[model samples]
Target: MNLNSKIEMQNSRSSSEICYENFMIFNSQRAGFTIVELMVTLVILAITLGAVYTTFIAQQRSFVTQDQITESQTESKIAFNILTKDLRNAGFAYPVYSNPPTFSGSVVPSENNNAGRDALTLVSGSQQVATLAQPLIIGQNIISITYTGSARFNLTDMANISIDGIDFSVITTCSFIGIGTDCDDNFVLTLNRGMNKPIPAGRPLYALTASTYCIVTDVTDTDNYLDLRRIAGIATLASCSGALPADVERVAENIEDIQFAYAIDSDADGLVDDQNANGVFDPGDYLTPPLPANSKILAVRVSILATTGKDDPSIEPSTKPYYSSGITLENNITDVSNDKQRRNIWSMEVALRNPR
Candidate 1:
């Protein structure tokens, strides 16, 4: 081959080789993604994150709602159980209550304290942890009683025990419970036993405890929410309507309202008659306030209105479905809480265990 031709061929071959190498380097450098692809990937990721966030929010809200509902229901149920146990012991005489009443209910305006709800007072025999061989007595330094029921009687559990209408404060006895007992496990009064009027065996003597259930304001929310409380002890029902009892305890919270009504078996029939004919009661069948006579109190109907203490913000804030609870609160403000709080009313009829 000619020298000029050979040089031209070699130069052409080198240029082709260089061009191939340049193409390979360019392809390697372009290995990643374009701006448009990156943008598309980001949009997909954003959609996925938004969906996950929405689900998490919904679940959290559901948990809050469930918790509120569970708490309200549990509190209400507890109150109901306590009331049932106490009311079942009302007028707890051997056969039936015949006297002017060791107890009374639907407390008057002065004792009730609040306007919307009703209160009830019940009396029963002091429960005993041990048996009794002899009669109970009031001694010089202490007062001890012969007990017959299953309820345990202790100084800590009992504030003021009464004999008829007389409170323990008048007995001039030590506040501590006596521990003296005979062969039958009967505890002694540990006082000057010479003086005391033993409650007649047939007449039946009791420890004389009293209970009053009503609605009142609590420390947490003194303005809107209300709580159910039991006011009890000496001189509550036994004495005249003068002052409220010192012993008070909260039964439940979020109790919006409580109402008490009396039922009578005027005809001595087993079933209660519906009075007022609104399909609810017949005239003289139900009494808002029990009659003064002890025999008139046959059965009691308790109605409790409860609510969730928390507000549901999904609705208009502070705006309730019901216009009013039919009365104003202690704050002198009407329409109850200023938010949407769920509420419900529960009613129960309890028959007197002992009645004339």
Candidate 2:
């Protein structure tokens, strides 16, 4: 009883002490979060990430929209300015031509429409010309001119001559200006290019060039960006549109459509000559018409539509058509597959300073 029982009791006491120590260590180590707490943290992190992403997307959309609108406005302004400058010079013949430039060449206003878009063909007689000193009748080639001017003339520069609206040149155009002595003669002009009519003295003469402006889409492009295109300084309008001439250039891109309407001064009242069927000459009650070919056009109203070439994926822009200055562009051929892209129309009125 003394040694055996005492030893057994000692062993039991040691085991109990070890068990107590382990229990205490376990309780101290279990001081972590519960499942619910961990879940709450994850939820907060997800919400923060989602908010940041949403803000980023919104800012990106705004950037795209603003950029596109600014681009369209810039292009429209450039095109309109160029067109106005050219049109104003329609009849301004540096030397003056018997046949000065006119609003429309020969075709009717109906024919001016190509592919549902307006086609503008105008002659530019506002070129420099050598002045004549002597009056030459029909079939006469030798004509005297002032020998000297601000710009000296070269024999190789002999291309075409116009006076009183008549063009004189051979197939190769005027071969050369032979020096001669005649009535105030500085130089003599020789021509075989069909000068069948009589010419008076002291006439304005210059070279000839024809220009036409229109809208077109190129063949190689996947997206027909409805660009503003032109056939610059060709011999005739017939050679211009059948196939784009080598000199054709794009003035502005993303121009959906361009239109022009002539202001006819039929009544000659000088106030836009608004010929309303109501017979009341009211303000803004203007008219667009079958203006006589080669007749006089006092004013021209031009409408242009432009767009952002791409769409904003995040924004839903307006689907309605553009309206401004009595010009309404309905569901035209803008090729807006999605309403995300922005588009607008601008209108302008330009007066023809020189009319043929």
Candidate 3:
């Protein structure tokens, strides 16, 4: 071939070989992103995970707060029910005294230095175990009764005779007139003291009980939380004159506060004597001096505040105020805390069933 034709062919061959090498080099190398691109992707992943974590934390806090609030509400409700039952049962088959002996009245209130916190004492007659078969005469020491069910009366067991729903007598000595056997059905009871007034036939015989409700610390628990305590005692002559027995029972747990307001007919006018002009018998109207002989208890207003028993970090400190009787309760003056624990308040007004 000619020299010029050979040179042109060599040049064309060289161009084709260079293009092939470039294509091979480009295809054989590993494909990857740049540092900037990788960094942007990582930042986006971190943001997404942060958002998810934040949402999870918020939801956890909400659940915990709700659970604590529910616990407080439940405890408050339980305390309210117990107080309602006792208040309704107060004065049942019991006498009303104007200047009542200590712990002998249907309702007794004790005021605390803290405005809204108060303690209450209630007198009630237990279930009727016996009924008068014959009319009980005045100054009678022996009585006849018909047992409706179980006879729980024993020797030296203090018995109460509700005479015409006015006069009350306590029997210090009680013995069944039976021949060495259990007292059942119709029986006789010999009393140590005679009745001051006559009781009609079919009058009920009951065992007296004096229950005092108060808030006290639960020393048995490691945390030493407060509890709604019920202290029960027999309403005998000695107990009425002296301090109450220490038959303590924990009614509800985590009870923070309890307050009481009484409705009293101080003049026997069959209406509440609102001395504070706040529309109810509140703090200042509490029985400080002994009530007049003709005064009668009509109703009672009760307030109970309960807590979750644990502090929650998510919630703010409580700023709410507590009130009882028309006075605001200050926690710090006596024993107050601004714990971040959830709290619930329950209130009720109960009317007495027995005649006042």
Candidate 4:
């Protein structure tokens, strides 16, 4: 009932009021966000996610395009390597003749023949498949030869009988002496035509092949991929015009077109003659079948066009550019301008290493 007791009560009351004010402030601070704040946060998160997703999709599309381009480049490189090697070895140990050679030159070119595409036939005797077991005399049609297990001689397969690697004769007939016996190691090959020159004993006999290279679409493949095909034993231009043989192999795939230009030594000066004074070898400078009497092919320019196997939807057909020159690619098929496919062209100039 004194002044001290009354002051204590008043202090306690003031303390309780302060505690209540602090609790109210705490509760107000803990209250959830406003609807407008939540919407704003959501919009920001959505924008950030959209940006990230867009970047990822762009990168994925770029990766796909690069992968396709790499595939096309690899195919082109393989085709170029094969063509360069064969062209360099053209005329390797060709037959020497007193008169003009019965066949054409070692590298026969059919320029712009197959639907505006070029065809080439290469003759080489570097693949030695057998050796003469006995001396071959002139005017002899039959001779004894020995070979290893690697020698695969089939009927109608041509072979060259060479003497000292200079004089040679082609075997037209491949009649074997022992029919019932296993002739894997040794056999007698009968040449319907007499030998051009006498080959001594122990000389190597080479397996001759006329391989023609051209671009075509394989009907056997469900995708109908464009392929570079090597037609073995086919030497004439007609070989490029006919339907593909069932036994033919696809040397390279995705090859859309092929072109050839020849550097000829028309004057026989041992150097390439431009013929038309142009720096580049044009179609006019090429040599066809039944080549001129003294003209020789020194080098060949091969251009191959390759394409990505699939069409890219990102590439607009209206904006896509045609990589190949305007030329017919196949029979009833021409260079497509709106295919929406990526394409590349690779060219190689190869000098003949064994020019006869």
- lDDT sort, best first: 4, 3, 2, 1
Q: What are the per-residue Cα lDDT tens digits for candidate 3 across 86-186? A: 88988876765542233447777644334445677787775567778889888887777776676455433335545445556655444444663344445
Which residue pairs overlap in candidate 3's backbone?
Answer: 98-293, 282-325, 283-325, 331-336
lDDT-superior candidate, 2 or 3: 3
Tens digits of lDDT, candidate 2, 272-351: 55456566644244344545443456667777877787876755444333222222432234344444566777777776
Global fold similarity of model 3 (TM-score):
0.68
* 305: Cα error in model 2, Å: 1.1
State which candidate has the highest TM-score: 4
Per-model TM-score on C-alpha atoms: 0.63, 0.63, 0.68, 0.76
What candidate 3 gets wrong by more than 4 Å, as runs, is 1-38, 96-103, 114-116, 130-151, 154-158, 161-168, 175-188, 192-204, 234-246, 274-294, 318-337
lDDT of 4 by residue, 56-132 (tens): 99999989989999989987898788888888887877764522133466877755554466778787776777777
Off by over 4 Å in 1: 1-29, 94-115, 135-206, 220-225, 234-247, 265-274, 277-284, 290-295, 315-337
Candidate no. 1 TM-score: 0.63
lDDT of each: 0.55, 0.59, 0.66, 0.69
- lDDT tens digits, residues 1-356, model 1? 99999999999999999999999999999989999999999999999999999999988887887788788988998997788677777654322322322334322222332344555666654432323334445443344454555443444223223343222322223334355212121333333223245443223234445666766666567555677877665434323221432367778999877666667655566556557656665434656643434324567666677788887555553254354453332212235545666666667777777543
lDDT of 1: 0.55
Lowest summed lDDT window (length 10), candidate 4:
323-332
Record all residue pairs in model 2 with backbone atoms less than 3 Å apart, i.e. clashing: 95-204, 97-165, 98-163, 98-164, 98-165, 99-165, 129-205, 169-193, 170-193
Q: Give the lowest summed-lDDT range of ten residues in model 2.
A: 322-331
Task: Identify the leading candidate in terms of lDDT.
Answer: 4
TM-score of 4: 0.76
lDDT of 2 at 47: 100
